[model samples]
Target: MTYRTSLTALALTLAGLVAHPSPAVALSSVQWKSCPAYSDEVIRSLRVTEEQVPAFRTLMKRLECGTVSVPLNHRDPGGRKIDIAVTRLAATDGSRRLGAIAVLPGGPGNSGYLDPILRSALRNKEMAGLNERYDIIGFDPRGVGYSTKAACPLSPMGPQEPGTMTKETARKIYDSQVATNQKCGRSDPAFLGQLTTANVAKDLDLVRAALGERTLNLLGFSWGTYLGMVYRSEFPEHTGRAFLDSVAPPWTRLDRHTKDAAAAAERNFGRMATWLARRDELYGLGATARQVREEVARLVGAYDKSPKTFAGLQRPIDGSAVADLAKLNSTEWVRAGKALAELRTTTGTTAPPTVKELLGAPMMGTPVPGAPETLNMTMNLAVACNEDAGRTGFDTAWRAHQRLVTRHPATGRGWGLGVRCAGWPLPVQETTLRRGGGSLVLAGHLHEFMSVYDWTLQTRRAVGGTVYTIADDVHVSATRVPECAADVVRYFDTGRIGSGCAGVALPS
Candidate 1:
């Protein structure tokens, strides 16, 4: 998945701040135990197949699962306590082990627990080297994953179809979001107040203490990079070597981030067009980048006029859905082009299975099984709505949306942080711009759709660090690119990372 697609889904799905120094909570002792069995629903949600369940379970058996109690309100440690679920894969070479390395997942709500296991299962050789020397830790932040969860009444409104929502429709959607917020606030004001990035950073320090680590090595991706930065700022003395991949800009507001994302989407879409044109013999979309883009525009217009209903799709396919298909990774461009070609032929034509599956994945709806009912959405909203330095009013959001649409018509409608958080209840938490002068490394793709290259430059300025650039359109480094992966491991092993790991060229 491209960073844009994942972030867009997260924007459509989850929905959070900072505050004054709270009384520090000492990390209580924890007893490690065997990981509990995962339900079929949870396994499927994790994208683990039923056939791999046994192996997954065996891997889980080797790991330890535990919980650490932390204050519900950091300001008052003696107040209500909440459990933070944690998992650890011990170092294989305990004799040569270094300190703990925590893997923070992207979504403010994404489970950190699965990353270590997933990396091990994939036999990520670079990560394997780090695993040999460091205890890989994963933990769900408060109100996420296996930790104490916060619930909210489901919003009746869904994401408005791109380019289709009018003033009245947008207002109704905004109203529904406010209603959902109102309901949640009424139920648990304290819990809602505490779900900020600063709190999560504090919780992480507690986790580090529980693991008996004086200093923490960090591997944070996407939003995790933001969390890692927070940790670096908060506990500079305790931060060890850190790798922040697909970094979020340290000072960019949510609205600016959205705008930057839209601009990046436009650039990435052009790159996709170039890639697709080179493969015209296979996909038959167009002969040049311009032609391919024109063809896409034509198709979008036609589909918007008369939406098509593919077999098994709950709703008819519209221009917004077709445009969104382009928002995927470059690897999926050919498939998306082919899918678009098939859809343009006949309204009744059944979409290719791949296309159907991609399109059928719910963009907005109820939370999936085994996922927290509202934590993901609520936390995202809480952090974004609170930490943002710009206006959070509906008018500002609507205007920004309009500007984004005007500038990048292809994937603009789904770009900005919508008006749902316009009237968020939490007080704005000023973002702290400090960074730990540790051995830090940040990486980004030149054509990254979500965390754009500009963010890397901004982050480098905000936090002194060396940047490893991948000249292609990949989202997070160290995931698919071997060079990037090796650089990450190399940095962790020896506090030095070489620059200029050329990006892999997309296959034509």
Candidate 2:
């Protein structure tokens, strides 16, 4: 599944001042286990069902994907089996075959199995050096697409509608999420319980053996960075080189990440306002960036005071609304500006365009609404729940809200960390995130809205590797910066890290 950094984690690493790589070796603790071997055809057949074979076969040529069956519980070597989906793009140049570079996509829920196809979106140019030498591989972790999925099936119906969630709604959505987790948890509590990073890293090692590789080079983004770090710690011997982009510190708890994301949203508002001011003619918000920011703040406040009618739904255009919008499409600065301008003019003034019209739902001109939540929420919650086990409950969350609102009035509740898992069903499987063995490279943004910088530092210390700081507002640098990409690619090509990077500052 695709994962992203919490806003808190993003903010702390914005300065782009994190650190460089270190010459570290992979961990030797993990012994390579014997994997049941399968032919290419057999491997391809494993990820699909009898009925899906036709489509799977057709798509395989386009994407060249395959699947492998693993025991549901690793400890119980002989047990009910689950499938792990994999896709690979072989080295275009056979003479340069470097091995395999595994990509761990963010979103504990985002499908990485299809990443080879999506590589054009964020694959580093520096990766070209290893293009012919190594195969780029993406996998769908358990409970995600094409893999043995854990069903928390959500209906397409809207929240206020029969199957969707609404402000007043509860059981339908709650049960869906809870029931999904319970079913997956019950399937093989031993393995499901063991779904921690440490074990997942072990799973990677097995995948490496299955593919007949000596070491695995990795490129991880956001939450994927943590997985890379964990794998580095658990099975350093398997490490070849790793590039961790938009890093989230290992020590960061769910509560802290959420809080920091809210704060970053506030900062984003200012940046967005400035962007809007530059194009005032299209959106007559203000003459200056600061002026435009005030107007935007006023618009958000007005929407909060009274829900606005948009896209046939009475939309509560509050902080959550703003955050969701940002997460859905932060890259399109101009389109978002236009939408904000229109929102200001139409809110409370008239029944604005349908939510679809307002959000440019058709996907031609603008992004589809709820895209971020649809792709991000499940995995975000999973990671948060797993990492922050000691904390739970509405009161605990409400108190956090109290602190956030006091500090950030403009974008507090809406931008603040949400407790969607307050009533989560299954207990978390892991808590502490430690770094050991291998030389891992963790990257962070100085002022990211989702993850905090401090968390990156904690993670760096835990992993004993350098953290690269971006010193910018952009979320994950792996996809955004060529320099960062070069740094990552260099690490993967050889076990060398740039000396320019540094460790997180210690607390006074």
Q: Which candidate's TM-score is highest?
A: 1
lDDT of each: 0.73, 0.56
Candidate 2 is scored at a TM of: 0.71
Task: Indicate the TM-score of model 1.
Answer: 0.89
Candidate 1 scores a C-alpha RMSD against the true structure in Å of: 6.3
Once superposed on the true structure, which residue ranges of model 2 sit more than 4 Å away at CA? 1-64, 120-129, 153-194, 277-290, 311-330, 347-384, 415-417, 431-437, 480-484, 494-508
**Per-residue lDDT of model 1, residues 66-185, tens digit only:** 998888777778988998888888887899887788988776677776667775443356666767878888888887868887765646566455435566766677777776765654
Q: Top lDDT: which candidate number?
A: 1
The Cα error of candidate 1 at residue 486, in Å, is 2.1
Model 1: worst 10 consecutive residues (lDDT sum): 9-18
TM-score of each: 0.89, 0.71
